[model samples]
Target: MAPRRCPCGTGLTYDGCCGRLHDGTATAGTAEQLMRSRYSAFAVGDPAYLLATWHSSTRPGRLELDPDVRWTGLEVLGTTGGSLLAAEGTVAFRASRLDDGVPGVQAEDSRFVREGGRWVYLDGVPLR
Candidate 1:
């Protein structure tokens, strides 16, 4: 069987992309990479990966994904900093999903920062 494509839309195999991060074999090299991996986590239904990559200050004690919401696609609109050398950064994206069979799109500009030299999601501002 062929390897599944990554949900991050990186055109790479899941194992070569976010899967490595999800499985703890790799760490995000940038904030944007972390954001993409987080989205992949949601698509693949791995809340543990989500919580592990989340910043401690804003991380919830537990995360429960709504079963009715099915992630469909991801579009990265823009990014700032979030480079291998940057300490902080932001990623703007629109994530498409189906909620109870209803189509929806969530747009947000997310913030990220390096903690212990690893990129972690901090927070996000919903875009209208």
Candidate 2:
């Protein structure tokens, strides 16, 4: 069987892209990379990876993904900072999904920060 493509929209296989991050074999080098991996986590239904990458300041006690929602695509609109040496950054993206067969898109400007030398998700501002 062929390897599955990464849902983060990177032109790479899941294992070569977000899967390595999700499985702990690698760590995200930048905030944008972390953000993409998080989107892939949601697409693949792995809440554990999502929670693990969440910043401690904003992480919830637990996460429950809606089984009826299927993530279809991720488009990174822009980025500011969040590089390998930066302590913080923001990613603007639009994520497409289907909720019980209803199509929808979520646009947000998400913030990220470096914690313990690893990038982690901080929070996001919903875009109108």
The models' CA-based lDDT, in order, is: 0.96, 0.96
Q: Write the per-residue lDDT of candidate 2 for residues 1-128, one digit (tens) a residue.
A: 99999999989999999999999999999889999999999999999999999999999999999999999999999999998999999999999999999999999999999888899999999998
lDDT of 1 by residue, 3-88 (tens): 99999999999999999999999999999999999999999999999999889999999999999999999999999999999999
Scored against the true structure, residue 90 in model 2 reaches a CA lDDT of 98
| C-alpha RMSD between model 1 and the true structure | 0.6
Prediction 1 TM-score vs. true: 0.98
The total number of steric clashes, by the backbone 3 Å criterion, in model 2 comes to 0
Task: Assess every candidate by TM-score.
Answer: 0.98, 0.98
